[model samples]
Target: MRSATSKARFPILLLTLLVSISAAAGEKLTALQLFQAKRYAEAQIAYEQLAAADPGNAETHFHLGLLALRRNATDTAIAELERAVALDGKNSDYFAQLGSAYGAAAQAAGLFSKAGLARKCRVALEKAVELDPDNLDAREGLVAFYRQAPAFVGGGIEKAYAEAEEIKNRDVLAGSLLLAQLATGEKKYDAAFATLDRVLADHPDAYLALYAYGRIAAESGLRLDVGERHLRRCLELPPPARAPAHAAVQWRLGLIAEKRPDLPAARAAYAAALELDPAFSPARDALARLPKP
Candidate 1:
């Protein structure tokens, strides 16, 4: 277990202070500006003040819940989100976040306790989808539930596949990658690749699809050559088409090279990742772990 002082802190959420917030009717924008500036500690304090001032504001609690989740304070996240849902019972997004918190907490729980948390996750996610049929994240959370939990508790690839079909009908690009990811989770590599093939065929320049393709290939140790190719292409894309987190693609490339036992390639990729964003700890750690030559 980590030390108590650090358990609820994330430096990534505390990085920049460039953008300023214009004075607005609501202080929520102020908190948002702080969050965007990566001043997470200040943002949390601001959010706490907002929540205290407006005890009935559901959105305040929701934002606090998000901040807590980013800090890995899942228990706090669940509490804040519960308040959000209690105040605004109609919000699908609130319930979805609560479910995500439950899921995160369940990862470290004992077997019996894990089951209970999983049940909470399942219930909240289902409620979110019921409240909003078009809630994509809620639907994906439910799919994750079916993929990971036991049959008695709600896990089933069959359920995930059914949800995948619904997603497919909604957004072809995202849906295809999501379906492929689900297939990957099921250990159906061939099927997953075939689905990805369709994604590439239809939208050859898609940012999400390329990242998904690279991630699956690297993580699964399948089609390494193809994975490396697409991952490199993903890294080369301009900001508009690049992944929101630019260093992520470089890390994926590093992962591919490392898994292939290509030490020099892995080191280069990791170095490139750190060059893009020195705060990217995964790349930094990977680079540090390489044997001194």
Candidate 2:
């Protein structure tokens, strides 16, 4: 009788173990799905629970970091991403995101702390690239940093160009866009337009190219009508992952409308931008600055 009872308990215990393992995996999937769906608040809670349950889980911390970053909680993002990197130093993505968080923190830091934070940001990004040379996001971050940072802080337009060339070698569209952006920054409007025109000719419906073209138009205040038309066309396209959000395109529309001196249209465009993303400070600020209706 005792032997029979022991055999019954062994099967029950094994089943319980399998169920627990399945539940843990399901939790991870559910949390990831929530994050991908942009249900960030819920995803944060779910990740926090997972972190609590499995404190060693680097993935959990990484997701939590990304969610915090989305909300502009840079401090929390840095902390969580740091944990992720500490747990998995070999992961290029973890280091890349940690670098981004560090960059954001540097931007918000006061003058005294800014340099140190920026250096950390650069180091992490460089490490990420070293770990995986094919990481476009990491390479893009390096390009942006090199383009924007002063020479003293390891920024150079030449370096930016080199990185853009590297990207172009891997992905023509992204590289062309980055190079065009670099040209735009230097007020080389013709060169910028020429590059973008080539992209548009090849991929007429590419939303990113359209948006980039519209952005240059808005920035230079040239070709307003064409820019507006292209931007409106961007709104009609399906937003793909990693592309500029609709809020950004709407903001550009507002800028173009303002350039046209169409006050009402500008106001409407800004309001539409805010409606899509209330946290979009540029749109919010622009809307607030308009004369009270």
Candidate 3:
């Protein structure tokens, strides 16, 4: 009984509806299952299909964004996550994901010498926190993003330090560690030392803080002795932490020894690092670079 125009549109409408429903069901099941199983690539495909079928499905887009993030597709993740947030403005998780996507993009941009992209990352992260004040992950991401981003790109060391202090008052050691990293980035060597000292004063065996301190020292080029001490302490920590710490410390020590032309010590350090983490590429590379003894 429909007119010709209606008839033509009717089939298309019906087909669209059917496709949407099928895609939704398939995406809902496959995305969740695959995501939970850590099959992010497959999950991304399913989410993409659903997003294509129903562009208004914010959750599907969000999942696709997360999947892209897992695969290190920062640009794709940003586009998908931004779409997801636009479609569902009230979802805190969407904002958080969007922020993380921006942060990833910033990291990629830094590698390519695109400062603007890094600034955009900070804006996205700030918006995420504004949207979800209680989201610890979002806050942590913001702090980390800011710390890694250049000062000229809205990532001042002072700001990072203040944020860390705020987090510490709230009893978040992880955030405090990130703040210390910011201090290190700023070349506020004394400030960095004080921040880590405070943290270690309260929790001396905090392996994460110790590791961060070691990394800061190694990179800053101003505190080799202090860095070496922190790294050694990290190695003394317990269990899984000890393994990573040992690897990192040994690698750094190997570099120091290499600089000093102490080939034997460098070789020993590199070997020890590899023993702790056989897959540590940096240590392996260092070993390769060492002079034959």
Number of the top TM-score candidate:
2
lDDT of 3 by residue, 84-202 (tens): 88898888778877777776666656556567776766776677667767666666766776566677788765666666666666665766776676766667777877778788888
Question: If candidate 2 were superposed on the true structure by all CA atoms, what would the RMSD be?
Answer: 4.3
| Per-candidate local distance difference test | 0.85, 0.92, 0.75
Among these predicted structures, which one has the highest lDDT? 2
Worst 10 residues of 1 by lDDT: 16-25
lDDT by residue (155-269, candidate 2, tens digit) is 8999999999899899989999999999999999989988888888889888988999899888889988988888999999987798989999999999998887887998999
Error of 1 at 203 (Å): 0.7
Better of 1 and 2 by TM-score: 2
Regions of candidate 2 where Cα sits further than 4 Å from its true position: 1-4, 221-293
Please give, for residues 1-293, the per-residue lDDT of candidate 1 as tens digits: 77766655645334322122223234788888888898989989988988887789898899899999998999899999999999999999999999999999999788879999999999999999899988999988887888778898888888888887787788787678778988887788889888888889878877788888888988899899998888778767764543546688888888899888888988988888889999999999988998865
Question: Where in model 1 is the C-alpha error above 4 Å?
Answer: 1-24, 36-38, 219-225, 239-293
Q: 93 in model 2: Cα distance from truth in Å?
A: 1.2
